[model samples]
Target: MHTRALVLFSGGQDSTTCLADALTRFERVETIGFDYGQRHHVELAQRGVVLREWRARFPAWAARLGDDHVLDVGVLGRVSETSLTRDMAFRMEAGGLPNTFVPGRNLLFLTLAAALAYRRGLTVLVTGVCETDYSGYPDCRDDTMKALQVALSLGMDQRLLIDTPLMWLDKAATWQLAHDLGQRADPAGGGDALVQLIVEHTHTCYAGDRTQRHAWGYGCGACPACDLRAAGWARWRGERGAG
Candidate 1:
């Protein structure tokens, strides 16, 4: 039997790279996305489109892959004090992190994914939490993921392997990986395949504008997301030129 993995997908760059990695490693992979009243719900819809494209591209992939599940868990936004959850006028604090840090967001998402996996008899849970190439989101670190994995296993009496393929790779490397995975590269596009997907399909904008496009993705260019994206663009473009 092919190893089954449940991906905590957000359709963002990191998660999409992780999803592509899961597709390569796991013979059977299904995605679980959340509509947690985020500033960017359009990204969730894009995730659906991406999945549809995947299914169409690989017709048998859906049978091997589980159906995409979208749950409206808006309680996180109601309870969390972070700006990402609440309608707080947050100013981005430099050298620390972005205002959109939704505390316990990944924890809650992973916990829910683990619960679903446990119920479905699946043992592998994959996520796209990158410690590098991201803000100071504490939950995106490996330590938190490990703790959550242990907690899930002990709580459910089932071993869950939480895979983080992008945890170690930087943003440029992530794009390179996506390019290596046969994702279409836009020649006129300065960024790699992952970056292009992130810009075109995903939404990292905290203010929630889907129509906007930067060198990175759809976000206010002044936000932390845009900063990281700009830095990544420079790095990838430089590397591409040098190569």
Candidate 2:
């Protein structure tokens, strides 16, 4: 079994939830983020806040949380002309994908993560990329991940495993997963505390607006990312109230 893991964390709702899950499962968990010159660079800043809060809040999981890495891959922005890398409207592109889709972003991230994991002797790599409740990004698909895992293992000559816990889960289920993870980590107030932490601390808005806060989280409330997050929060709440 892979006892150590390296998570591709972006300090967003999904990545934070994935990190929490990793902390619960792995004996050692580390995080990696990229400085790709994204529009929502504020999310990068929130990474430290999330880590600190986790240590203060969940002592059990804090033991498993290890080093963090921020790679300076600003060349992604220079090559990709997407809305995330440039000031462009969020719309479908000529390739029938959202403009927010940064080509080769996830590919490079996982590749780099594999290299780092190899050096750290970590056998597992966890990512928050999801097909459900996500913008239409081909790289986010399960098939792509599987292929990449195969190729990476062959190229690196190591039995590295790529785990995507959120691949089939939608946003609402993602919220529930975080709640369950928190409950397992700190039963006293784990679920509620984690949800609250995610809402207040994680950043998902494409516009990088932190001054404005909403019931779901902090965002501009109009971008596709915000829309998906808000809708998931509403659905999660509604299901809980119904139960």
Candidate 3:
């Protein structure tokens, strides 16, 4: 029954998929992106570009998608020394979380998104957090999101639903979901435009290297993000071919 939603978007593949999914399910959908001083700040920049492109590509769905709000939380970057917020090399040593794991990044993001939703009378908050192919971030877990949902509701005195459509889905399944949603939203004969939008426009690279382009999108192909995305794309192609 929750018709209004705010998606915690990062302009990445997962988030962009969530946004596309939201546009289909929600009566009104808005997006919130953060500038928490991440090293790949280009993701934030690409958010605006993605929104603009979506508006042009699907004019009928544009109004329902609503506006994208980018918040400035530069202090998060200043206080956190994770590789994602600095120029450090990526490392995921045994028995330890990766350096790319930004501490409390999702927690802070969801908290702020909930606050915004509460203020705006939105009852649902969508996030693209997935545990299946995630980077071992504790906050991205299902239990964490469930607990946060209850806490946010109790703390804000509002019934808030935290939607995680990608929770159980791997990257390939995520791509499939995007493809399905895109096709459903297509106004023309085919949904190739929507699929291309996701493939070419969305930014998923931790290194944020747009110069190094690939079939999936822009990224430093060496980074973990890019590797995961590439694997997913390959799996998706394999599935499509087999089908």
In order, candidate lDDTs are 0.74, 0.93, 0.87
Off by over 4 Å in 2: none
Residue 2 C-alpha lDDT in model 2: 87
Lowest summed-lDDT stretch of 10 residues in model 2? 234-243
lDDT of 1 by residue, 181-228 (tens): 534322333224344455577655665666667666677676566667
In terms of TM-score, the best-performing candidate is 2
lDDT of 3 by residue, 1-243 (tens): 799999998888899889888889999998899988788888888888888898998876797987778889888898897888888899995658888887888889989999888888789999999899978999999999999999999999989999999999999898888888877887563266776887888888888789987887888999889999999988988999942
**Candidate 2's TM-score:** 0.98
Give the winner by lDDT: 2 or 3: 2
Q: Between candidates 1 and 3, which one is better according to TM-score?
A: 3
Candidates in descending lDDT order: 2, 3, 1
- Please, what is the TM-score per model? 0.85, 0.98, 0.96
Task: Write the residue-wise lDDT of candidate 2 on 1-243 in tens digits.
Answer: 789999999999999999998998899999999999999999999999999898999988888899999999999999998899998888987878989999899999999999999999999999999998899899999999999999999989999999999999999999999999999888898999999999999999999999899998899999999999999988998999942
Q: Candidate 2 at residue 8, lDDT?
A: 95
For model 2, the local distance difference test gives: 0.93
Worst lDDT run of 10 residues, candidate 3, spans: 186-195
Pairs in clash, predicted candidate 3: none
